[model samples]
Target chain A: MNPTLDKLLGGKQGAIGLAVLAALILVVFPLLLDAFRLNMVGKYLTYAFVAVGLVLCWGYGGILSLGQGIFFGLGGYCMAMFLKLEASDPESTKIQSTPGIPDFMDWNQITELPMLWQPFHSFGFTLLAVIAVPVLLALVIGLTMFKRRVGDVYFSIVTQAIALILTVLIIGQQGYTGGVNGITDLKTLMGWDIRTDEAKLILYFVSAFLLFGCILLARFIIASKLGRLLLAMRDKEERVRFSGYDVASFKIFVFCVGAAFSAIGGAMFTLQVGFMSPSFVGIVPSIEMVIFAAVGGRLSLLGAVYGALLVNFGKTYFSESFPELWLYLMGGLFIAVVMYFPNGLAGLWDSHGKRWLTRIKPKANAPVKTEPVAKPVAKAAPTPELETTP
Target chain B: MEWLSEFGAIAAMQGFNGLSVFCVLLLMALGLAIIFGQMGVINMAHGEFLTIGAYTTFVVSSLTEQYAPAFGPYYFFFAIVLSFLIAGAIGWLVEWAMISKLYQRPLDTLLATWGLSLVMQQTFRSIFGAREVSATLPEWLMGSWNPTETIDIPRNGLFVMGLTILLTAIIFLMLYRSRWGLQVRATMQNRVMSRAVGINTKRVDRMTFALGCGVAGVAGAAFTTIGSTGPTAGSLYIVDTFLVVVFGGAASLFGTIASAFSIAQAQSIMEFFMSGSMAKVLTLSAVILILMMRPQGLFSIKVRK
Candidate 1:
């Protein structure tokens, strides 16, 4: 009983922490916010998916991918293509020279649907492509780069370049991609009107549930011995390699998983936001995704969710009132987070909030003895890392 | 014979354009390499400092045009000097306040400096407004050189190229031949030993960082001749600057120049035939592929792990 609970939650503290976050996501947010605000929260939650993946890939495996938006966009564009095909039926586009292709394509004088958009006609195929394409691309990148032993900074630059290339391609190909405007005017999903308020509420819950499931999956991975090995690799690469591990394969696996995770977020974002664009696939947004991870506490998956919410909320609030000031606040957050709070909200909670918790609830100390001990701090904390991730 | 001459003129003009891009890239990449390759601090705001120089040039030009019209022809030289001094001064303060504490954490430097870049960009927007502004070039720097009827090179482009060559020579000499250069190199190679030998490593660190930023300011001054400057102009070139520094092998000045020259020329030439976005895609993909094959970069720089 104890071991199963530990495996699922790390310890009693992790269990309680996860429960509180789950309650807030499920209850507090929905109850307080109006439909519009809830929808904004849903969009921010999508970014949390990428931030959670960052925690796994960067925090543990020591692979910092600055181009996560590539996978996100790939996943989103795949879904967008399928929806666009559904929307652009021959009946809807009869006014154009070409009746079967999308409006943008007809506007650009494209007579027929391109071969690339044909496969997306099938929902099942599109869904599979969303996950498979990003994973495949990430696998190729990981294997080629990691095997050659590229350093961290170089890997980051290469990923960023890939993001830039993808954005440019999407923007340049007006007829094929709808150009810089991105694929829009999405109406239905599987013949159901997704534009209704009721439908949006349902989608929000669905997104939240999927995010929790990802949180659990991430929690499980970090709790496993493989996760520990990943941390070891980050701290000391040669020492971990000397201990008879194929570090390259592990790195590749994590990268593929990270791609898959971000892809899921992208798909959900398309569903909630009802559009996908090259703007999200570029360097600026990709780097902003990293900031989401950083602000949430790079080591904590749960912190990532809150981080995304808080930052996005601040951005929306400030930009609405004072457009120019938003940049200053965001820039300040980046500097403050990096300089003083590297661990992010999770770290702050661990260092300061724990003492407060101890004072408020004496019963919480019951699990302290049962919790696992530290490994001596080596630039990272020795214990309570599980507390960071929900 | 007429058609041949037309093609010849096209090739010559493109070649000159490529040379200008190469010069700008080299100047920017040199500053970045010194900060990143030598100091091992990835200053993402290197481009912002370069922007500072461009803005400085703009300010000087506006001043000379409005207040000191007679000084118009010589304003550019003073602008370059002022840009170097102001940017270098800021670099010194940044090193003192932020950079010194974060040298042990390289990735954190990328984050902090990125934040710094955004702040600087927003500051630029606030000060200069969101619109792009171009500086007025002196009469001597304007127009083109008609070296035969078939070939004409822009005078500003030639002047910028010459400036690049002169600065490169100066940087090479300062880094290798000067006493301060020895101290900086020694401290970078072995901090403890250099400190023990009375190198004043902290002072060396500040000076080296300032010098790199100073050169970037000069690059920004050169940029005014080729393109318009805006709040986000520095950002548009920062990533490309980083790629150039990395591809060249961070440690080698010669490698930086070679990579910059090739990247500039390739992009310039391809842009003529293909769409701008396609050219970027092709060039970036090629660079990524090459980097994969040779992860150590075009040249290897050995340092103890």
Candidate 2:
């Protein structure tokens, strides 16, 4: 490997993990899997976005948000709104009472476009909103909760309520939000028919590229000096505060970042799945997203993606064959994961796989190991879950 | 004069509706308050245990009506006791197998119990089928009483309220006035010290959990009077039940009851004017706001952080 490329990859393990993930997602999956299976993988990758976000928020920052689906849903809805507007042009909607509004709104007897849906008519605005909406919500929530030092279980519960509230609000305001069925019949993006097989294949690559870009961006953030603070704050927040840091801002920042990541995933989900709905924006899905992060190894960004895919894969297969057995298996999986494997998949890899990586390439051995970055993460390992990672 | 009477009748009905809702919530919260307040173990599966009580009632109700029609009218009392014992036994097994090792980790307990809830729900679906079931009530539980030509109340509502009150009084007496209460309280405050003083805190923990679950079972029994039983019924109520306990102050029995009363009443009254979902959305929003404003909840006891 080139010296510059080696430095870019950080270590031998990092490079190998990157190659395997990239090849599988970009080349192997698309080649081996049919269009239907590829679309399914695309759908699963959308969840990987949430899992990665969870790795930052819960695994690193010690904030377990059970409402990530809200942000993901918001992002997806923003994109869906744009697509729906394009599909529901006056020419296409002439059969409805209203000639310009969405079919659902027209069906529900909404004569004109609602105030909120108007902005979504602009693709540029929708693009901005896909990231902005969730980040803004997280900002307010984090500022309110973290400033008051309401955290851990309280934070988790409050997030769950937010998810519950959002779902109820959407279902209740069906004329505006598309209700329990959600914003569906999304057909195109900027006159390009997203419903076509070729377009879906393109969308798959676009999402795959975007996901890898996010992984790189997250890695950049995690490798910084600020990343060290997140680890410190997770374990000994008092010491960090006593050491004279504004803890609330850091907490808020990581949460916002996580929200942004989830939003991106949600947007991609709508593009690939061809719909955005309340089914993805609730407590059950949100908690399931956390389990994805947890199973992937909360501490490892790469592991989160695999975790999401694996869990969803298992779910799809199991529910198909034995619907009655699915809940028991899923329930038992949660218990088993929590009880036995606190460190998750990545942590398991680190214990065993890291040694092999070092053996294969001696240059991956680092002077960074001499520093204090290693200690706080070990301390952050609570009784049931978590393990140190650097 | 007619309009005034009409208004009074509506108010009277809504008040009973609220009171019935309050009774259900209080019965659920009381059990939660005991376990959560004393041990600080958040049981996400508490709702499932409540389902256990409900299904037990359903089974007994069906059996008596089918096998012995003469006993159908009187089998409810027997069903309640059976509900308590079955739910309590499950609680004991759960405590021994799962919760005992997870005492030091509250959040993990939440996750594990959640898993347990899923398993319990699945078990119910497999055993009873997925559709909702209701018990055959005795003839005495039939009909409504009219205080005046304009005002009326369901007999079942009043019966449930009566049952709730009886259970509450019994629980309060047992938990506060008895020697066992002293031991439990002692263990709750200082586990190590209580053990040093020969309190057998472990036994207290198991008994406390069993008692809390047993109470939840009775709540489930009372629930059969007003609502049908389904596998997911417990789940539908779990979040609201947790809110009642937390908003009332996790450790305070009176607070739990007070909070439950206010929430239930608010929901019932709002339900008359708004969509049921909207009413729930508003109530939950208010509760969340209150909790954020006073993170300790409405009636929190001062303890060293």
Candidate 3:
């Protein structure tokens, strides 16, 4: 009834969708799944953060970054660093050649903690670094590429190259970055032992809350006038630039937002998974993250979340049962989605599922009669406010 | 005097090694340049095509060894030709099935090609098993061409170099001197206009893609001389190949050659001094920095968008 609240929730339809997703994630998942499965869901939710960011960056802004994993890894590594330092206290590590530094460093014969690892000793600083580090890198990339008018396939290739470079650098600098094994044996988080089931459950809820917060923030942005400009920019860059709207800055802004969201996801992932590795920070994982958004209906923020869950579920299940078939299935999904289902599950729902729902319940058909006329506008333009879910 | 001569020999050997690398890169980048630069289609499965060639060589080597041992030495030449034809045929099929539909959507094409690459990799894994396999080279292709005591170059390296030179020359000749080259150039410059002028632009696109893929197959055959082939071997070089093509300025074949040479040399030289991974990181960083500064790349022609 209240306009501001209604707008924040993306009108009545978005409100209903948000409520259903919230109930599914917070209530249903927790009630139905065991701690281990719920933790896995939490991990998937962290990826959902990147998927949501992709919805804004690739779907709305049309800047397809194939390197969101870089930001996610940066955030995860930052959190891992702080936890690793706390775990590597002089008491627990007295047998080592170096008492206070990470075990990987000591293994590599380094005596002193590197200058880069020193600041991560402070949790406050680590928290800031998680977001700031990724944003800074995104800023540099955005400024360089966008300012010079490098976009489309060029930007994607450059980002993919950057992901490759970061992965190689991390793996090569094994002593400093824990090499290929990644930052492992992470036990405590600021004196809280995260290995416990109770701790895992709490963390899952915390992640759920954070995810909802991100979705709302994304919804707020999409509802604003700035969102319209992003749509305009995606469709016709020249027109937006000619209209004196400094198109590059808007691009940089959305890209940074995406990077920031991915970084948050990364930090949460480390907290839940207890480690971070180059396997997650490379071209493959980065592109897989894109597919999460793709399968979810890139245009719908909530759909991206579901896409991440469904794809990761399939990956885990198929890989565990039939490892040989997983890659083929994943590959097939990518091709099939691109060819026939570009709009993803959400689009399918809009085109067919909603019509079926109305027909089943004729009493609700009156309100739905007006929807078909407005449906094309929402489907065609995809201004987030107009997106409806049943 | 003895030490100076030894140092000279080592330098010469490393330089030759660099040259060998340069030849491989040029072969890969040449195919990529035509596909990405000329047609504006980003084929992420380009590496898989190389794998197709490599696997084709592997199969030919085994078959020749099994039933036709007398044809061992000469089988390689036939294999190379077969690799080109097979890879080109698959490329033609891919163009018809998937690529032609996504010409307007470059990003989607990238995703779709990546999918194609995954499927191809799985096929390789299924057929060849997950282990790395190499072709059995003939005795003449083994051993070294020793210029000095420390500067012994493998004969296979020289052979690969010759093959690269021959292919590069043929590609250049086909691109510049032939009637097909004119149609390709015309199609690239203005597809709609070329179609209006009675050029079968669609056929040109298909042929150009297949030719690019065929070149990749030849590159794969060359690759077996220097390294073993695996299911994902092609992917390892995809980024480097793309960088070479980008650095060379996508549209120019000459630029691809130049970029490949410089990049391979830089990487090999740095590799000699530092750890191989560090050398790669530094070389790639330098390339990215340069690319950021000059987004059009090293050898772009001025053309109005």
Q: After superposition, how far is residue B226 of candidate 3 from its true place, in Å?
A: 1.6
Decoy 3 TM-score against native: 0.96
Off by over 4 Å in 3: A363-390
Per-residue lDDT of B161-236 in model 2, one digit per residue for the tens? 9998998898788878999988987888788889999998888999999989998898898889888999988887
Residue lDDT tens for model 1, A106-126: 889888889998899899999
Candidate that beats the other on TM-score, 1 or 2, i.e. the better one: 1
Q: Estimate how well candidate 1 is docked, as a DockQ score.
A: 0.75
| lDDT per residue (tens digit) for residues A1-390 in model 3 | 886677679998899999999999999999999999999999999999999999999999999999999999999999999999999999999999989889999999999999999999999999999999999999999999999999689899999999999999999999999999999999999899999999999999998999899999988888888899999999999999999999889999999999999999999999999999999999999999999999999899999999999999999999999999998999998899999999898888888888778766865556757768766867888767343444
Model 1's CAPRI class is medium
lDDT of 3 at A81: 94
Tens digit of per-residue lDDT, candidate 3, span B227-287? 8999999998888888889888889888888889989999999999999999999999999
Which residue pairs show collisions in model 1? none
TM-score of chain B of each: 0.97, 0.97, 0.98
Give the per-residue lDDT of model 1 (tens digit) for B1-305: 99999899999899988988899889889898889878888898999999999999999999999999999999999999999999999999999989998988777788888889899999999999999999999999999999779788889999999999999999889888999878878898999999999889999999889989999999999999888999988888888888888888887888898999999999999999999889988987888888899876787568886
State TM-scores per candidate.
0.95, 0.93, 0.96
lDDT of 2 by residue, A266-331 (tens): 999999999999999998899899889878988888999999999999999999999999999989
Q: What local lDDT score does residue A275 receive in model 2, on the 0 to 100 scale? A: 95
Give the alpha-carbon lDDT of every model.
Answer: 0.89, 0.88, 0.92
Candidates by lDDT, descending order = 3, 1, 2
